[model samples]
Target: MKYRSRTDIFASILQSANSNKGVGITTIMYKSFLSHYQLKKYLSIMLENDLIKLEEDEHLYRITEKGLRFLQLFSNINELIDTTKEYNV
Candidate 1:
């Protein structure tokens, strides 16, 4: 895998959350190709920033409206950058 910027990582994580009704940590980890520690670190930042929310009852993470916007902007930027849009690459 090529080096991924934090923005790329954030976008990857958010994409995982958005595609599912609700996603668990393991699912996010696999989808985002993150380690447990990295997942914890990024998820904490995302939760604190209100980009994602945890449903305690379900033990699942869901994307916030802000996260959707972020993904939109990320897509726009990727279009301009002409980077690969392939997931799980």
Candidate 2:
């Protein structure tokens, strides 16, 4: 398997959370293919940046509007990169 960049990991986590109503940390880690330590580090950064919010009462995490925007932007960027590669540009 290839190594995933931090941005890729972040996008994966966001996508996972966005798909589920209230995703737990363990679920995100598994879906994102990240180790527990890596997940914790990324989760901390994401929470601090307001990309994801924690539902303390439910003990679950949910993606915020900012995270959705990031995901959309990331997808667009990836598409652009792929197109560039196809054209060898």
Among these predicted structures, which one has the highest lDDT?
1
Candidate 1 lDDT, 1-89, residue by residue in tens: 98999999999999999855799999999999999999999999999999999999999999999999999999998789756566675
Summed backbone clashes in each candidate are 0, 0
Question: Which digits, one per residue and each the tens of the lDDT, describe model 2 over residues 6-65?
Answer: 899999999889955789989998899989998999999999999999999998999999
Query: How do all models score by TM-score?
Result: 0.90, 0.88
Off by over 4 Å in 1: 84-89
| Candidate 2: residue 27 Cα off by (Å) | 0.9
Scored against the true structure, residue 76 in model 2 reaches a CA lDDT of 94
Per-residue error (Å), model 2, residue 9: 0.6
Question: Candidate 2 clashing pairs?
Answer: none
Clashing pairs in 1: none
RMSD (CA, Å), candidate 2 to true, equals 2.6
lDDT of each: 0.93, 0.90
